[model samples]
Target chain A: MSTARANRMTPYLFLAPAGIVLAVALFYPICYMIYASFLDWNPSQRIGEADFIGLRNYTKLFSDAAFRESMWVTIKFSMVVVTIEMILGVGLALLLDRNIRGMSVLRTLFILPMMIAPIVVGLMWRYMYHPTVGIFNRTLTDWGFDPIPWLADGDWAFASVVIADVWQWTPFIFILSLAALQSLPASAIEASKIDGATGWQQIIYIKLPLMLPVLIVTLLLRLIDSFKVLEVILVMTNGGPGLSTEILSLRINRTASEFRELGEAAAMSNLLLIVLLILTFTMFIYNKAQDARMARLRKVEEEV
Target chain B: MSDKTYDRQNPAFYALLIALVVMAIGPIYLMLATSLKLNVDIMSDSSSLLFMPTLRNYETALCDFLWYEPEHLRRCDPTFGRALVNSLVIGLVSTAITLVIGTMAAYALVRFRFMGRDVVSLWTLMMRMVPPAVLLVPVFGIWTFQFGIDGSRGGIVLVYVALNLPFVIWILQSFIVQVPIQLEEAARMDGAGPFQVFFLVVLPLIKPGIAAASIFTFRVAWNEFLLANALADRNSRTVPVTIVNSLTEFDIDWGVIMATGMLLAIPPIIFTFVASRQIITGMTAGAVKG
Candidate 1:
């Protein structure tokens, strides 16, 4: 009886430490954030002393032009970056799906940009974008062309940050899509070839359809990450020249730290969290539907 | 899959590959080159590649660690050195703690049929999407007023472990699921308890998973700046926080800063080269599995 009791308790005992930590550190904080969002809170005052000005922060944020601009910038940044990365990454994956020597070496080299600290990535780009001393401008001047203000002009700063992000993260999609492409059941492709399908046709008709699931998940994951991007942009432009490069994360940081408006920052965080949750749930639903389809297919196979 | 046979490629194809490789490594090469060059070389519009290298920047960044003071140094700023130590301690300790509890929790979820496992799964998935920025406000508030653990390494470690645990558990669960049940049963038959079976049998089988998880955990803990910026005081600043703090200066030391940036980049770079396969595996498992 005691042994049975011990056996029943084993999982809980195993789970207890992690559960306790997550509850105190993650779950509690999230709850606190949601509650704090409704209050007129600031960094100087304790949470208890803050006025319970319900929905004012949210209302103020909607009316606030700066917050709206930051949201638009965040959305614009995510869209541009993810779209460009997806195209370049998936295109490269398709192009290089063949067996080649030094592929591992290539992969190792590719991941270096991503594996390095984002701060370092920002630093590298900042140096490369340095107006007078930068590589791009230096080359342009060498060619007798005018130097482009990479991070100085508003439009160029957005483009420059986008370029930096693409450089760092394109490899992520490349590697994933490559894995997806490589893992594709070869028999389907073989059958397609036997049916006189060309390389392009094979990619479009067969390979792409099979890789769709992985691609969607990768896209969503990248979307979530792009929203979370802060350090690189913070280091690069500090959301400056104007509000041109100020994404939501940077705005949130500035709000809490610079503006000292804790409640507004919390509200901004909640809004960002909601957007992410939608993406996450979409992915989750897709996974569930896929799992169900797989189960049903397996059941049919077993029956057959 | 006799796909191992190499394909014949056009010369243009190889040229394209070379171009791609250059595009990938160019900025990193520039950073390394810049870090090696003197301020004079960096400032001068000489030919890009022909400069005598120097370790002066590295010496300047790591001045506190050097036994003998170099002749060029006037005043040594100890911030980078101290930040480096704080980063390592916080990263390693948090990774260790996260892996320990994370593995156990994952094992439990996998090996035992527990109520609320679905709930746990949903929670983990939800938690994974909560950006560090979102946590900045609440974490700052709670750490400051409620926990009183603000401005300490332990506080930073606590948040990191929490932030990383969901992913670690989610990843390790898949690995633990693949551990053959009969092996654990055989161990149990030989008078081993549950913990013994877990530690001795299941743990050894999942070394690759653990390696992958640790790299990711350590990467996040090491690279994270936002929360660390909020949580860490001057004395407890990580490399990322210190680097950001220094960026706000009127006149920047590009060479020394690049050296500091290079130092921060070194571990992850090493990890990538050493375990590129495992890192790729972890990444694929993360997105592809989801």
Candidate 2:
């Protein structure tokens, strides 16, 4: 074979393993889930034996109160966690965007929570939130205050789980936002300072607007991740306190394993998949738009 | 002149930075403090800033039996030690496989102009975005029925590779592209074949990139919980699953659980500290440059 042709063929050859795995493992399962969602699948029956109920699963999902509640819970959880995490993460980033001694060490330690396994995080917080003997309530009692029902009441349970999630994941946004903050046009911020802009004003007008693109992508990424969170909540609450904290992934998990409704669980997963698909599509488009704009600016520079 | 003036007048900046640092690290300090205390101390004197440290929790974690032996299954048993070993083995092996394959794919994408390259790039990016829970059921079915690799370390390894390959490929591709093509061309013109050029000329240039990608892949596999939890039965449970399983509604043992948490955290913590500079720079550059 010619060298050039051989070179052309090498990439395809190298891509073969990843391509096959993605097809079988990722694409295949998604297709399977889509097909399974169309069936009235029960754990007792084989998939082939299950009745083919086209769109019925989707239709039933729209009116199902439990499904609706779970969806609402997921939406609320994602919004609340992402909102608080973004604020704290960015606030922390803005405050810590500096070159002080030991800053790097502190930044590394800050992101340690994100590196721990979600299940481990869930366990860690559960110990800290233990009702009678957990550090939180114990501290409260030590302070001569009543021990609050952290994981018992519905609202408290939801808030507690959210707190655990925010604790673990806020570092994600912090790192990304810090990167964005550091990469902002340094000259622009300096000019804003010379223009008599205070620190807060410089942040609002100069740094944040410049960091908007990264912030949007980070927010969308966190949103998609939060929607699919299961392990932490599973380990912490097991979707307990009367299902008050049962987000969609946890609900889907229980439906498959606990309720033994494999087909319905598959259908619910597809619904979650669609929601994620929309978010992913939005992110993809946003990325493409940003790239195209950058390319256009490059072309303009070249022409000039 | 601007630098000196700014440095002298940044008192508020220093104060804000100190406050941010404290807030960021406060929880971890709490976790470390809590981990060092006795269970009774943790429960009783939670507000006290100082305490007599105890190594009893670590001792108990190392020498404890939190297993259930079914009457029929006399010979088989599970322990935290086995799970920790399994997690380390699986994580290392999967990361090795991912780095080799992903580096090759990344090199091809960077150096070779071929059909479907753009599509492949887009697909890999999309793969990173796929939620793991969405694939839990189907993956379980695939492993059990189709591949017959269910509940094995090998099965978990395959899943980790499939899940982490995109990240590996994406990061390595950027790193590989930064390597000048002319160097490979020079090696080829000097009688080196493509493979020889890649091995001798190109690989050495991108070691930092490969290191960065390898650490990330290892971290992902090590810290992954859901797929391991779903795929691995008692025989092949991972560290995260074992630690999580320690918690029960009845008769919880906080000491052992904290000890295991400390153990589970040590590897990643050590890796991070050792490669803190490289990993942080790689991640920050990957985000902005991409």
Candidate 3:
């Protein structure tokens, strides 16, 4: 081959391994799951032996109350966690966006929660939320107050999982928001300040608007992630306090393992997959829009 | 007086910020404090902020047979030491593999104008968007069936690489694009082979990018739980898996779990502290600029 031809082929050569892996490991599994979702699959039955139900599983799931509850729990959980995390995260980023000694250390410390293994985080928070011995109740007792049921009560169990999730993942938003904040054009904010805009006013009118794109992407990313969350809640509550904390992933786990309804679980996963697909599609479209906008701006600059 | 005036002007803002920070980090602080307290102390004053602190929890966690059955002589509790080692091995090895393979792919994507380039890039991006849950059942089936690689560290490592490859490729590709191709062209003109040019010229040029990618991969693998739980049996259990298994509501040991959490958080926390600036800059350079 000519040198140019060889050079052009080099990328394809390098990309082969990853391509094969993705094709086999990713696409194949997804196809298998999709195929399996069509079957009356039980744990014992092989794919070949299983009767192909042809959307029966999906149809069954629509009327399943437990599955519906799980979906509701997932939606509620994602909404609550993402909303609170965004608020706290953006709020924290705004607060910490300043030059000071040890600020980097403080910022690193702030994001520490996101670094620990989710299972470890779940275990850690579980310990801290222990009814009789956890630090929350311990501290409350020290203050001469009655210890509230943290994990036993259904509502509290849901809130407990949300708290642990927010604790671990809010840092994701914090770092992204902080980066967005730092990247905002300084002069715009400086001009706003000079125009008698208060800090809050500047943040509202200038900073937030500038950071909106990053925030939206980050929000979508977090939402997508929160939808798939399983390990922490599994480790912490095991979807306990009578299914109060059972998010979709947990429900899928239990359905497959505990209920031994592999087909049902697969169907539920397909539902979750659809929800995520919508979110992912929205994000993809949003990203394309932003990229197109940037390309237009670049073209304008080139013309200038 | 000027300082006082400034303080007065920013009072509520500063207060709100401080309160938010405290709220954000409150549970972690509580975990740390609880990790240092004795079980008796922890249990006795479940609501008490004022406890005589002790290192007994850490001591018991690290030294004592908290989960030992005396008659059986089998340590039923998962050892934090073993889990740590497993995590480090899996994280480091997978990260190294990812770096090598991902960099090569990224370099190709950035430099080569070839057929299916857009499709390749799109494939890589879509890999990242594939949620772990979607793959778990299928992967579990595949690993258990095809390879008989059930619950092995190697199996988990392979899955981690698959999970992390797209991210590494995307990030490294951006960095590789920032590297000028003219240098490689010059190296080629000097009769350097592709391998020589890559290793001697381009590799050193993207060391920081590689470092950032490597560290990010390491963090992801280290913090990963789902695949580890799915793939690794007790013999190859990672820190996260061990910690999860430790949480037994019927006969819970809060202190040991807290101690394990503290231990699990240490590596990544230390990593963040050591490379905070590099991480911040590297992450933004790839993410924000794109």
> Considering every candidate listed, which one attains the maximal DockQ?
1
Instruction: List TM-scores for all candidates, in order.
Output: 0.98, 0.91, 0.89
Candidate 1 local lDDT, residue A183: 85
Question: Of the candidates numbered 1 and 3, which has the greater lDDT value?
Answer: 1
Q: Give the poorly placed runs of model 3, Cα more than 4 Å off.
A: A1-8, A301-304, B1-21, B24-26, B46-81, B115-121, B281-287
Off by over 4 Å in 2: A1-6, A42-46, A302-304, B1-23, B33-38, B45-52, B64-78, B116-118
Best by TM-score: 1
Write one digit per residue (lDDT tens) for candidate 2, span B1-290.
Answer: 12432223277876876775666556556666667787777667445477898766655555434343334333433378788789989999999988887877788877875646557667776777777878777777667767879899999999888888887888888778888888988888898877788789988999998888888888888988777877899989998878766675477766667777778777777777778766776666534654
Selected candidate, larger lDDT, 2 vs 3: 2
- Deviation from truth (RMSD, Å), model 2: 4.0
TM-score of chain A of each: 0.98, 0.96, 0.95
Q: Each candidate's DockQ score against the native complex?
A: 0.85, 0.46, 0.44
Candidate 3 chain B, run of 10 with poorest lDDT = B1-10
lDDT of model 2, residue B93? 98
Ranking by TM-score: 1, 2, 3
Tell me the lDDT of model 2 at A95: 75
lDDT at position A8, candidate 2:
64
